[model samples]
Target: MNSVFTEDTKTGDIIIQFPAASKLFKEYKIDFCCGGNRPIGEVIKSQQLEDKDLIKVLNIMYEQMQTTEEIDWMTMPLTDLVNHIIHHYHAKTRDLLEELSAFVSKVYRVHGERDSHLKEVYTQFFLLKDELEQHLLGEEQRIFPKVMEYDLNNSLETLEEARAEINILEKEHEGAGDILKKIRQATNDYELPMDACNTYRLTYLKLEELESLTFDHIHLENNVLFRRL
Candidate 1:
C-alpha cells in the first residue's frame, strides 16, 4: 500500500528529524539503531507491524517535538552531544554502578534470607555493571573517536565503519535492557518489600535511577548522534 510516509525514507532520518519518534520506536521495539539505514516502510512490513499505528504515533510525536521540554539534540553538534554523553552520562554511570555494586552486594548479604530476589538483583546488576563498563570503554576508545573523525573529515568509509560499530553497540544496549528488565521484574518495579531495610530500599532506588539514565543515554546516541551519519 502506498503510504504518506515514503517507503524510501530512512528510519534514522525520521527519528533524527523528529526526536519524539524515538519513544514510538521504543514502544514498538523497532531497532532504529542497527537498522537505521533501512526504509521505514520496509522495516514495518518486514516486522509484520501495522504501519498505520506507527505512522500515527510518529505524527503525534513530531508535533510534540515542536513544544516538548526535551533537549533538541538534533540542532546540537555531534561533538557536543558526545561530550555530554561522556561527562554527563558515562562518567555518572561509572560512579553510580560502582556504588551500586557495593551497595547491592552488602544488601544481598544482609537481607538475602528475607527476600530471595535480592540475590538475583545482585547478580543481574553486576552483569549489567560489567557490560556497561566495557560498553563505555568501547565508545570512548573506538566508536566515539571514529565518529569524531568522520565528523571532522566527512569520510564515507569512516562513516560506514562507525555505523557498523553502532549496530554492535545497539545489541549491547539490548542486552543491558534485558538485564534491567530482569532486575525490575525481580524487584517488582523497584518496590520495597514490607521488611526492606534502608540499604535494600536505597539499592532499589538506585537501580531505578540507573535504568532511567541508561534509557536517556541510549536514546540520545541512537536517535540523535547516529542519525547524522
Candidate 2:
C-alpha cells in the first residue's frame, strides 16, 4: 500500500523496505528475494503471470495495508476457491508450459551447441511440465470435486467417505510437493546464465512462476482444504 516501491521500481527495490510484501512474495515462491533487481513488468512477463489478476490482488493489498488482512482466503467455499485457482493459476501454468516448451526447443536448437546447460535445463523443463500437467488434472477431476462434495454434505456416510478421500488427497499433495522441489532444483534455483538469451531468460522466469503457483497450490490444499476436512 501507498506504493511500497514506486511503479518504476524493480522488485529488489522495496523488498527490504516492506518485509510483509517480501514475505507474501516468498510465500507465493516469487523471486523477489533473489531476482528482486528485475523490474516488476519483466518479472511478471517472464513468469507468465496474469497481469490483471495480479494487479487486482495488489490493489486489494494496497487498500488493506497488510497482506494478512487483504483477502479472506479462508472464507471462500472450497469449490469456488478451487475453481479460481484452476482458472487463474493452473490454466496459466498450462500456458507457460507450452510457451516454455517452445522457447526451450528454440533455444536448444540455436544455442545448445554452445551452452550444454541449455539442453539439460530443457530436458528438465519438459519432464517437469508433463508431471505438473498430470498433477493438475488429478486435482481437478478427483480431489477437488470430492472435497467440495464432502464440504457440502453433513451426513455420516458422507463424512466417512470424505475422510477416506482426504487421506488419498493428502498423499498426493506430498508427492506433488516432491516433484515441485525437483523441478526447482533441476532449474538450479532458476538461475539464468550470464549469456542467457531472451528465450533463456523467459524460460527461467516461467520456472519461477511455476514454483510460486505450486507453492500456493499446495498451501491451499494442505492448510486450507485439509483444515476443512
Candidate 3:
C-alpha cells in the first residue's frame, strides 16, 4: 500500500477534496458518482486494478490539484451561488445538450452502420438529453426559485416545499446519472475506435465533457446547496 493514498479513502471524497482526481478516476473507468462512496481499495479490488499503479497516479494528481484554482463555494452568499449555478451549469448544459444531440445524430447516421454500438450510444444520449432538459426546466422555473425564496425568508411553508422539491430533484439526478452510465458503458468509457471519423471522435469527446460537467453540477447541488437548507 502506498503511503500517499490510503485504502480507506472514499472515491467521491478523493474527487471532492482534489478535483484533479476526477481525471484519474475517469482514466480508470471508476464510477465516482453513483458508486462514489466506496473505499478506494474496494473499488480497486472490484476493478482488478493494481493498487501501486493507482497510488502513483493519485500522488501525481494530488500535486497537480494543489496548483489548480480552487473555489470556496461553501463560503459564497446563497444568492450568488444560486446565480452561478444557473448561469454556469444550467445554461451550459442546455447548450451542450443541443450540440450533442445534433452531433450524435450525424455520427449515428454515418458511422453507426459499421459500429452497432453507436446506435446504443445515440439512444442513451437522447434519453439523457431529454431528461436533462426537463430537469433544468424544473429547476429554473420552480425549484430554484423556491429555494431562493426559502433562503431569503425561512418560513415553514417554504422550507417544506423546498425539501419536497429537492427530494424529487435528487431522484431525477439519479435517473439522469443512470442514463449517463449506460452511455459510458456502451461507448467503452468514451474511447474512440481506431477507424473513428472526426465527427465520431468529437462526439465522444463532447460526451465525456458533458459527463464531467454534469457530475460537478450534481455534486454542487446535492452536497453543497441542498445541505445548506
Candidate 4:
C-alpha cells in the first residue's frame, strides 16, 4: 500500500487506511466515524482549520506509525479513559459550544434579516448545545463513575450498572446526531450565502467543529466504553 498521504483523499478513507489517523482526527476534532464521507480539504475548510498545519500533522503521524503500536482502547484503565475523555473532549467541547453559541447569537442579531438562515442556524445550535450539556452531565455523573467503580472493584455488578447507563447515553447520542443532520441539511452542509459576512463563515466553521466533537464523544461512549462494559 502507498504510504503517501494525499490532500485530495477523503478524510474517512485515510482513517480507514491509517489507524493513526483515528488519533489525529481525535486531536484535530475531525469526524471520521459518522461524517467521514467528505474530502479532507472540504472538512478542513469548513472547520476553518489551517490546511497546511493539518497536513503537516498527518504526515508526521503517518511517519511515526511506521514504528509505533496502535493505542489499545480496551486495555486502558477505565479511570484513565474516563479522565481523558472528560479533560480533553468534554471540557474542550463545552468551551467551543459556548463560543459558538455567542458567535451565532451575534450573527443573528447583526445579519439575521439579510441572511435568514442565520436565525435557523442559531436555533439549531442552541438545541445542540443544550442537549450536549445534558449529555456530558450524564456521562460524568452516572456513566463514568460506574466505569471507574468497575475498574477499582472488578465487579460484575459495577459493570452491569455501567451498561444500564450506557443504554441511555446511546439514545441521547442518536438524538444529538439527528439534530446535527438537520442543521447540515438546513445550511446545505454549512454552505454560506453570497452575501455572508465573516460571522457567517465563523458559524459554519463552528458547526464543523461541533460535528467533529460530537462524533468523537459518541465514538468513545459507543465503540470504546460500551465494549468495556
Candidate 5:
C-alpha cells in the first residue's frame, strides 16, 4: 500500500481519497477546492512554498488517517452522501451564516470609516452569504434530488440533469471561492486591530470559521459527490 502523496497528486483527488486531507491543506493555506483539479506542485511552486515538506507531511497525514475509522464518502451510496452533505454541511452552514450576518453588518457599519477594508469585507461577506444561501437551496431543491433519484433507479434522464446542474454549481463554487478570498485579503486574514472590541473580534473569528466551512463544503461537493455523479 503506497501511503505517499506526492506533488504530482491532484489536489481534489486527495480530498476524495482522504476527506481529512482538507485539514492539512487548510492549515497550509493551500487551496484544494476551486483549484482542486490542479496538481499540488503547481500551488506549492506558485506560492513559493517549495522549501516546505508539504508532500512529506501530506503523505504522513494520509498514512495516519488510514488507521482511523472515518466515513469514506468515495465509496458510500450516493443517497447517503447527499444526505450527509445536507445534514453536515448545509444545515450547519445556514445557521452559521445567519448567526454571522448581524455581526458582519455591525462591524462594517461601526468601523468602515476607520478602516476601508472593513467595508470591502462587509460587501464581500453579504455577497457570499447571498450566493451560498441560494446555492444550498439549489442543491437541496434541484441537483440533489436528481442525484438521489439516479442513485435509486439509475435513470439516464435524471443523470443527465444532475450532470448539467453539477456543472453550473461548479461555476458558482468558483465565484464563491473568489469572493471568500477577497474577503480574507481585505480582513488581512482576520487579524484584529489593537483596539478591537468583542464584536469586532467575534466578527472576524466567525468570518474565518465561515471561510473554513465553505472550503470544506465546496471540497465535498466538487471533489467527492460531483465525481460520483
Candidate 6:
C-alpha cells in the first residue's frame, strides 16, 4: 500500500506527522525519543527488528486515527512550544510524581515483604523521581527562559547556548529512559500478583501511566523541541 511516510522517513518526523506512529514505535521498542534522528528503516535494521510491512500497517492505523486533537508542534513558535512543554509536561509531571511517590512508598512499605520486586521498583522510581525533579527545575529556571529569549531575539549566541544546554538535557533524557526501562523490567511490565492489595494495584497502574507520560514527554523534548533548537 502506498503510504504517506516511507521507510526512509526519519523516525522523529514520522511521529511528528502521525500521532499513531509513536504508539506503534513504542510497541515495537523503537527508540523514538533520544534516538529519533535516524530513519525508521535504519533504526529497525540496527535494532534487528523483523516486521512484515510495518509501514503499511502504520499507514492503515493512521487512517483510523482521525481525531483532530493533536497539536501541530512542529510548526509552532519556539516560545509557544516552551510554554506548552512547561504547562503540559512539566507541571503535570510534578503533580504526578508527588502523588505517585506517596503511592509507591505505601506499596513498598506494605507489600515489599511479600514481593521482592517492590524493593527494586521502589528504588528505581525514587531515583527517577529525583532526576526528573532536578531536570524539570533546570528546564524551568534556566533552559526554558533561554529558549524563549532565543526565540524572541533570534540571536546566534543564545541559539548556541540553548543547543549546548539541550545536549545536556538529551543526556538526562537517556538516563531517565534507562531508569524507566529498568522499572518496567523490575515490575515485569506492571504485572500484579494474586496477593496484591488495592494499593499494590494502584501503584502499578500509576507507574504505567507515568511510563507513558515520560515517553511522550521525552519524545516531545528530544524529538520536537530539541530539534528546533
> Largest TM-score belongs to which candidate?
5
lDDT of 6 by residue, 1-229 (tens): 4577777888878788886687778777777777777888887777777565677787787777765887788889999999888998888888889999999999989888988998999999999999999999998887888899998999989888888788788899999999999999998877889888898888888887788788888889888888878
lDDT of each: 0.79, 0.64, 0.81, 0.77, 0.87, 0.85
lDDT of 1 at 167: 76
What's the lDDT for residue 129 in model 1? 94
lDDT of 2 by residue, 1-229 (tens): 4544444556644443343455556645555533455676666677777544554465456556655544555677767877887898789878878877887788789888986766676776777777778878877876666666766775556556556766666666566556556656756677777888787787667767766666556555555555566
Pick by lDDT: which candidate is best? 5
Error of 4 at 72 (Å): 2.0
Taking all chains together, the TM-score of candidate 1 against the true structure is 0.73
- Tens digit of lDDT per residue, candidate 4, span 1-229? 3446666777756664565677677666576654555778778888889645787677777776763465566678889989989998999889999898788899889888977776777888899899999989888998788889889999999888888876688778878888887888788877788987887798788888888777766766666667567
For model 1, the local distance difference test gives: 0.79
TM-score for each candidate, following the candidate numbering: 0.73, 0.64, 0.83, 0.73, 0.95, 0.91
Which 10 successive residues of model 1 have the least lDDT summed? 1-10
* Residue-level lDDT tens digits of model 3 in 175-207: 988888899889887788898889888888899
Q: What tens-digit string does per-residue lDDT give for candidate 1 at 16-114?
A: 666566667765656555456688878888888874567665665565455556666777777787888999999999999988988999998988898
Which is the winner by lDDT between candidate 1 and candidate 4? 1
User: In model 3, which range of ten residues has the least summed lDDT?
Assistant: 59-68
> After superposition on all CA atoms, how large is the RMSD of candidate 2?
10.3
Q: Which residue segments of model 3 deviate by more than 4 Å?
A: 1-9, 53-69
lDDT of 4 at 195: 82
Point out the higher-scoring one by TM-score: 2 or 5.
5
- Clash pairs, model 5 backbone: none
RMSD of 5: 1.5
